[model samples]
Target: MRLPEHFLNNRKLESLVENQSSFTLDHAAMHIFETHQQAEQVLLQFDQPVLASMIEGKKVMHLRDYESFQFLPGESLVLPSGELMCIDFPEAEYENPTRCLAMAISEEKITKVLDWMNETMPKTGGLHWGLMDYNFHFVNDAAVFQILQRLVFLFTEDHPYKDYFVDNMLRELIIRILQTNELKIYGSDTFTLRENSRLAHVVRYIRTHLHESLDIATLSKEACMSASHFHRVFKNELGISPVEFINNERVKLAVSLLQNPEISIKEVYMCCGFESRSYFNRVFKHKQQITPGDYQRLLQRSMF
Candidate 1:
């Protein structure tokens, strides 16, 4: 998304690099940081938990205990309140400046959301819903990207009810982030060994039986849950329905299968347990924004 010309022109020339512009609401604040020259070991910290996303250019993040990694656009990192960040801008220039946005969220707002989640959502292994208390860096998914874009608009736009709009979006954004953290943990290969979480066992079962016909009843039995409760818990925990999760796993399998040049599209879909080619095409297109055939063709072309 492009910054408005007025916003760009109106920024105060406070510093050559890491110039900051802030917009505040009742429960949160948004900040835009632009760096116009090469910089090293730039220090940043937040008094409140912050969700930081790269808008343009690159940054090398230096965090304790982890190797420095490139922070690029379309990626985000969540830091707990007061966590220090050491960032480097190696490619900032007058013509191509590095830009990033940080949304600092109030503890009250976080508590409200966490209360609602704990009251409504049920987690396996007797875990309660809480924001992970460490650094979480990930590439933004579609839902996350959409919410961030809306947040940028809400933060910058002039409106009579801007606070109300931002509050609602903040709740949603927090939920999305929490769900993403859950997915990251439960969706990993290491999580399968965690026997206390029935959901993890269910995920393992789904992976092993991905090429077979799967039904809610069978999966519910695996989790020792009733069908209705299973569906509700799964969706509440993962923010996606069982059918959606199964299809997603199937699509992942189809992607791996398509890597083999010898596989036909029909065979790929069949082996991934898709019911029919047309249905597979629809689901794959919806998930990947590209048809399987097109993806395969592109892959083949890249190979050659």
Candidate 2:
């Protein structure tokens, strides 16, 4: 998950201070905002729904009743159309200004995409497309980041056939955004999307049974699809293979288990489904950048 720093740096302009530089096409717009001086309570509203991503520096966002939070690099916020956001540039200075992009999207284009998704790939168990709502912040993953970077190129291009390109990219961008949103809400209390989606059903199964031996065949059965078909669809929908996702979920659980100083590192790994200590240690360090024992000690120190 590297941030799209190249696109961010390329888009920056010298006149930084609500300079209002934007590129627009048929169904989407990219607004690049840079603030050189510290500012507070800067009001920003979009006529269409916007996916605001933090490019550089940081911002203190105050949206609706949600408490103030930092919008740092490698993060994004999906907002509804006509929503007013009050943002603060607390760290903006002459040398280091806050840079962000607000990509306002056309409702008509979104509706068309939504209709197509529901019609073709209709969720078997839950809601269809139209995943965009009031949910604000999200971490940028590879799929979402790549399409967004492509869009930077598309928006800046003056080619006459750019509209066709815009149409294609807009569909992709919106779909990726929707998928990102769905992933965000998957297991949380707000997750109500039950499209009978095979990938989602498989994912839901994996989340519930992370401690068990979840082989591909068993998971495929939960999705009611053949093993090979399930594998392809799972990776396509979620951007990760079934095995990688299992390990990710296990690692997430391991982090929580490590917080308990009473639980030994060996016990933590076993509970999270790792077969051996060496393997567990390698995976833990790879994902968390620290050994499980070190993480446990860090947690132990914090308790005091």
lDDT of all predictions, in order shown?
Answer: 0.89, 0.78
TM-score for candidate 2: 0.85
- Residue pairs clashing, model 1: none
Name the candidate that leads on TM-score: 1
Candidate 2: residue 123 lDDT (0-100): 49
Relative to the unseen true structure, what is the C-alpha lDDT of residue 200 in candidate 1, on a scale of 0 to 100?
86
Query: Once superposed on the true structure, which residue ranges of model 2 sit more than 4 Å away at CA?
Result: 1-16, 189-204, 232-239
Tens digit per residue, CA lDDT, model 2, 59-175: 999988788899998899989888888988888987887878788988899899999877765544455566565745888877777777777677766688988987998888787
lDDT of 1 by residue, 148-196 (tens): 9888888888899999999999999999888878777766667633567
Q: What clash pairs does model 2 have?
A: 123-195, 124-195, 124-196, 125-194, 125-195, 125-196, 126-194, 126-195
Q: Provide the lDDT at 239 for model 1.
A: 75
How many angstroms is residue 262 displaced in model 1 relative to the true structure, after the best TM-score fit?
3.6
